[model samples]
Target: MVSKEKLNRINELSKKSKEEGLNTAEKEEQHELRTEYLKVFRERFKKKLDSIEIVDDETGNNT
Candidate 1:
């Protein structure tokens, strides 16, 4: 059996962790939404590059 204060502390930490987990999940969802928004713009930008000559920066060769 645990002491009353120890048990209370454990309970408090549990609640705190639960709240933190929810906050982290919310942030992750927001990040994913921002990534998807960028993806839409990236696709549009790719169309403009198709006609330009592509070069590989790593090897200094045409890709």
Candidate 2:
């Protein structure tokens, strides 16, 4: 999970973008934060998928 502070910053940046817009540095920071957030999210999702077991109903088997 992304840190709470970073998440808050991401939200702040988004709101600023819609309202007054961001400077170059803020835009870069937002991009980096979003990339990190997506990376963590994707990793966690993959871990959840890996932990799932598929079962075959007809044969009473698990794969």
In order of appearance, the predictions have TM-scores of: 0.38, 0.91
What candidate 2 gets wrong by more than 4 Å, as runs, is none
Against the reference, the lDDT scores of all candidates come to 0.60, 0.98
Tell me the tens digit of each residue's lDDT in model 2 across 1-63.
Answer: 899999999999999999999999999999999999999999999999999999999997996
Poorest 10 consecutive residues by lDDT, candidate 1: 1-10
Give the Å shift of residue 7 in candidate 2.
0.5
**Which is the leading candidate under TM-score?**
2
lDDT of 2 at 37: 98
TM-score of 2: 0.91
Q: Across residues 1-63, which tens digit of lDDT does each residue of candidate 1 receive?
A: 334664455455456567764366655654554465567668768876776788899988987
RMSD of 1: 16.2
**Clash-forming residue pairs, model 2:** none
